[model samples]
Target: MFRFLRGLVLPEAACEEANSSSRYENLFKKLDLNEDGRVDIAELHAGLKALGIPLGKDAEEKIFKTGDSNKDGQLDFKEFMQYLKDHEKKMKLAFRSLDKNNDGKIEASEIVQSLKILGINISEQQAEKILKSIDADGTMTVDWNEWRDHFLFNPATDIEEIIRYWKHSTVLDIGDSLTIPDEFTEEEKKSGQWWRQLLSGGVAGAVSRTGTAPLDRLKVMMQVHGSKSNKMNISSGLKQMVKEGGVRSLWRGNGVNVIKIAPETAIKFWAYEQYKKIFANEDGKIGTVERFVSGSLAGATAQTSIYPMEVLKTRLAVGKTGQYSGMFDCAKKIFKREGLKAFYKGYVPNILGIIPYAGIDLAVYEALKTAWLDHYASDSANPGVFVLLGCGTVSSTCGQLASYPLALIRTRMQAQALLEGAPQLNMVGLFQRIIANEGILGLYRGIGPNFMKVLPAVSISYVVYEKMKQNLGIA
Candidate 1:
């Protein structure tokens, strides 16, 4: 594993530094950016800048004069070798200086102090974030081996480059592949990036839900009209929608759907991050079970917060054209007629569904991620796109399947108040009524449309999410 990480970071550093014939080759290649096998003063300056080493012109000139034995303004292999020896000696001294306690490791405070000396002002939080990246043993400190391996190839130290390399490093077997991106340190949770993460999640959710809006409308129609005179099958449902309000009708209720997604995703993501912190162990590691619990709680919290939008969405989907003009109008009518309880009509079943839905979803996804990592990504850390899609689709499907019946019940309860002469039923009464009227299979009335939408919806969602992160330079 150590050798694998070294290869990813410094592919040429195979042999130990104690008895290596070509120890300076990787260093030389880094300095020789054009790969001309020679290090010019310009290349050296750029290399030092990349390494976060601020060398003044005079200091650079001094090194160039000492290393350029041939006096050709460039250092050949042998000349570069001499420079490399001096560079390592300097780095060793610097590392020792930072190891203030002489414990052969750099702690967060020590690193912060060293950075301050270099005119870099960083909080202890930032210091720990940096150390945690290189801390291989979970000790939250950088050992000599880790320190040397990290700086072996003279990796970039600028914040932008650091983030990029950190993400790139995930593609290599530097260590475990289960590092949760959403799991935040105490410091990072309060950082500006927290808001950015929430915003990204909101955008991803909106895009995914909107992309699947047609099928979502179909699902609602099937759930409500499957047993009515409409006899809503997918084909009939689509036809009925177009007949009613044209192609645009296919996206009925999508406005509320899209609006609800932003807050739902942002709340869920933020809550999940917080819950993970609360549930994490002393080591600050959250296990799979804890993750599932956190996800379930987060889902429920988000659902409860935006549940009125869900109710409004359902009413608009099943309502006739003259029934409600928009989401606000729908909410106004529901509140005026049925009071506040109308907005939470299906609160029982909706909240109930979160348990199985979130539990199964998270459990299945984590299991699949672990399986892919163990089976295929054991050799290479990052799995292929197809693997991720397969896992996401299957896991989401299984989760939806487990909770679909409850979701159908919730939808029915939410829309029940809108149907004239239909009795308002409690959770148990609704279950019995569905069973008596449409049989047990009635609970899964819209399942086909729901299933049909899962793959594409989840695929697009994940794809957009990844692209967004990459674009934002977060990934």
Candidate 2:
């Protein structure tokens, strides 16, 4: 009698298992959008769109070409899985590399060494100061678990959450709650709205450029020469630069950077708005995944158009003493030397980085603003300075961390053109060089000052922009 009942249950169990397996299998199959047993460019695009994951044209091409095995131009289930696995592996490797001693903890020396490798010119004294600020325990070394749990993965202080909050609050009209009136004439559309975007973007561009120019110059300098060299510290570096080339040297790439700013910011904001509108409902609410998808897509789109200028800007910023007199000269020189495509030398990592950086940065900014307005601010129209500062700090920190690796790659590629007799610095060459010279830790240089810089800059920019927009009633 027992055997008979067991037999019946066994068949039912097998059937249930089969059903569950089939469901997962189907889901994996969907990831292969082209149905070619792999996910190709079209398939990846369709699948990401379906899943609300945004992939720019460049990213799609890179992923398809690399992720697909056998050059079949598609990503089979195995290939897709492998790509995900590889990402996880890299993350794990990053964590491991950060944990210098096999003792599973990160020491001050380890962190300092990591920065040194990435071309950041931080003294051991500075690293010690940073560690003391973050480390509450008297422990001289931070453990891997502690580094991850407390520093990298702390939920209360997660950079991703902070960034999302900031983005949510900063946008003029998120979701469908805000609407532009259709009664506006076409001329008004071009002259009024377009002009506002352009002007605002120009302001943003100018502010961002001015705020970052010095630091950008310093960062490129450190990357070109080893960080241990004399011109690594900010004040010392600035002094040396001025001494060598005069005060004007500090603003080496300002011309191009300033010009690029208006269109870059305008396009980025516009793309972000358009992308958000496409995916979100009228109420301005979207699921978490959808927000990520939209933000990433928007970032990729914006970066693609603006990237050439960025390359030129970087080249101008780090070239040998006086490579080109001005932005136009630099552009002409690059065109003549490397052809039109040279302007987009580091296009790959840049696009990939922008997706996450913009998406997370915007999302966090909005979220932080919303939180501040709801809990802390007496009025949404005029949140306190502290509230804005806090929001900016959180949002920028998250955006930088997520995009650090790509930033490293971009800086390397941009500086490559200026390095005499240096081998071409593709992504692979950059990574290998970093690994060989500095070990795995070479990829996160300048992250400390970068974090410090981004927080204040973004925070101030957002607060000012928001106040200006509100005053103008341009939302």
Candidate 3:
């Protein structure tokens, strides 16, 4: 069941691993700039960076020496293979180091002692929780097989690579949310076919937005008018939209919504990479906090760049019949009548919301991923699709919970003028009105529809993104 779930949620990694050896060979060839049969220190350094493994100078030198078994100052195929073999051996020794008394299995007590030596400062209960995950026999002890399978699949030998991969691949319950690293791999960067990443992201965004357009439209309506109209709900909102503009009204703002996805995603991706470069350490690796900061800044940059489209989208959605023919008309009318400030009505809340939503979402996801790795993952590097789904669901749920009120306020602010009889409320004024008129719960108006969209949206985006990458021949 676990294997099945993993295959479902993380098929990309599973399917891609089958061709990993070939991919590695191809990667090696790409790194061999001079077409030499052996790889020198310079070539190896370049190759690791190309593979997204950024080592500091000393670390790089150490890796080179480790691989050059014959003291040849470079790595031949034999030496390279030996180095790979040695990495596995070193990891096995790490496992043994945890098993005190030369025992074949590790108990919770052993875990506590080992973690203490590393200054982890965990309680025995926490140690037991960690052991419980890989305790296949339910004896509350991790046997040789369990220990080996749990840590052996990871390929990084050096601490830098280990921490980097751990930060990227596993989620850590680090109390607060941080950013998830970019999904693109080093091989994808080396391919110089960058458009594929943008294409995949754009397609994923489009598909998610389009598929959930109706719910989105409904949510907008509810946010703007639900407090005034107590009868408003999902079904009534749908009926109201159809009555106002016809069944097609459900997608009134979809054009602008879809239009902004490509550039937004591309810009965010680029900004994120640049930010990563900026935040990276001497080893060319970034910590989780750095990743979160980079991601938040990137999101803010993308949001600011494409904010006008968001305004246009909201206007189109909230517009009454004959108010505007299309998004262009809506944009033109807003610019001409309301001026430039109109396009930025909800900009502050929107930007502010990104921090909590992205931060909490990222943090929770990393925490969940870390917990699963600590507990359930053995043999398989991935905990599986179900685990991914759980992480996303929980993270998104928490993020939405934290940011929903702000989002509601932003939506109301954006569409305030569109509703003829509605009062114009600034950020603080809007919060006051909502609280006084409809109570705190009013702040969560239309959240049901909003929450309903999360699962399908995330699933579609992830699955489509992966499929598109494969179809585009991205490594």
**TM-score for all models, in order of appearance:** 0.66, 0.53, 0.66
Candidate 1 clash figure, as a count: 0
By descending lDDT, how would the candidates be arranged?
Answer: 3, 1, 2
lDDT of 3 by residue, 218-311 (tens): 8888888897556699988898889888988898888888888767767777888999889888867666577678888988888889888888
- How many steric overlaps are in each model, in order? 0, 32, 8
Candidates 1 and 3 compared by TM-score, better number:
1
lDDT of 2 at 40: 58
In candidate 2, how many Å is residue 281 off?
Answer: 6.1
State how far residue 106 of model 2 sits from its true place (Å). Answer: 51
* lDDT of candidate 2 over 1-475, digit per residue (tens): 2122223222233324335344334545756654556555766567655654444564466555556777877566777656544543444455576566677666668766764432223345545554553443547565433333222211112222212222233322110101111111233355475456445535654665566666667666665554422336666666777887877787787677677655655565566567666877675544445555655665566667877888887888776567687778888999999889888887888777765665566567666655544454331123444665666457656666777777778778877867789798788788888778776556776554555456445644555565555455453
lDDT, candidates in the order shown:
0.67, 0.56, 0.68
Cα lDDT of model 1 by residue, 1-475, tens digit: 3334554434443436754435566556666888888877788888766655545554566577667887988888888767656655655665786788999989989976765443234456656766765665669887766766554434222322223211211111100011122443333455465556556655666687777888888899899778845577989888888888788777779888877756766677778778888998885666556766776787778888998988898899988766788888998999999899888888888888777765565567657755554444423333555665676567656767888888888888899987889988888998898889888888889888877876677667666766776666454
What is the Cα-based TM-score of model 3? 0.66
Model 1 worst lDDT window (10 residues): 168-177
- Position 194, candidate 3: lDDT: 62
